[model samples]
Target: MSTLTHHKKSVRAMAQHPKDINSFASVSADNVKKFNLPNGEFLHNMMSQQKTIVNAMAVNRDGVMATGAAVFALSYDVTGTRLVTCGADKTIKMWKKDQNATPETHPLNFKPPKDIRRF
Candidate 1:
């Protein structure tokens, strides 16, 4: 198995185990890797054909959810409230920040994040 790491806040391979609601865990190919949330928590990973060297990784500057494929890209609004993600299947997903929840600790609430398809 190979890992990818890039960007100031985005990392490819998890260096530790998922500890609390402050980190993000990845589940793929029967492996569970742990990742710390950069800037805040949670984000999308970039990939192609579900099997290739991931190109880039970046933090959302805030938080978000995804769908229809492993996240291949991620972006955020200037205020760090809105999040957007692109999946390996070529689907783009968008999420509205939960203004009530703490941005840095939000994604921890949803392990194995559920991707909400943008219609």
Candidate 2:
């Protein structure tokens, strides 16, 4: 028998939050790493802290979804509602932030449909 190993892809996009100076990046390892850029230099070992997986990334807009992630098809809406994400899992999700939300959680939703293709 033979064994196969797959490697996760590197970061897809790196963007700075328009509302804040903090840096945000989505790595293919299913993680959205956040960091603070004191200067131009990137701080090291920051990913080891959160140790979470994101896969995709999007910014906040008009009191809508702030951050979202998936395996693939990551979309960032700079001036709209809903952060759309589609992945290899053959699914699509729409995340949004609700104004009347509570702490430790933001109002967001997802839709599981067939794969979505965008040009």
Candidate 3:
């Protein structure tokens, strides 16, 4: 068996890619990190707007991912195009990938919040 040791804090949840057998994700504190299979190399961090420890995660057959923190549940629609999450704040949030978004418009290098908390 292979072991991955990249998470800096205790992992709270994990989910294998439903469409990519060689890919998976793990939640550590507020970050969701992706990793390659077999070799177990770190790929990158998944985009997240959450500020608390993620307690649940799921991936759909279309490669869409969902993460929830202080959340009771998260799920992907049957079409694999939409994700829904319900949190303790008594709110339900739905997410969809923006097909028109580009790296130029949604750059990945944005600085993290100065008050962001990490384990």
lDDT of each: 0.42, 0.46, 0.76
Model 2 agreement with the true structure over 76-116: per-residue lDDT tens digits: 56556657778767988776767777755754464422332
Q: Is 1 or 2 the stronger prediction by TM-score?
A: 2
Q: How many clashing pairs per prediction, in order?
A: 4, 6, 0
Candidates sorted on TM-score, descending: 3, 2, 1
Q: What is the Cα-based TM-score of model 2?
A: 0.43
Q: Can you write out model 1's per-residue Cα lDDT over 8-99, one digit (the tens) per residue?
A: 33334332221344665443432223345444333443221233334233334333322222665665556656667777777777777465
Index of the highest-lDDT prediction: 3
| Cα error, candidate 2, residue 93 (Å) | 2.1
Model 3 C-alpha lDDT per residue in residues 1-119, reported as the tens digit of each score: 77788777778788888867897888878467888888888887775445577788887886656666788678888888888888889999988889999999988885765543321
- State the displacement of the C-alpha of residue 93, model 3, in Å, after optimal TM-score superposition: 10
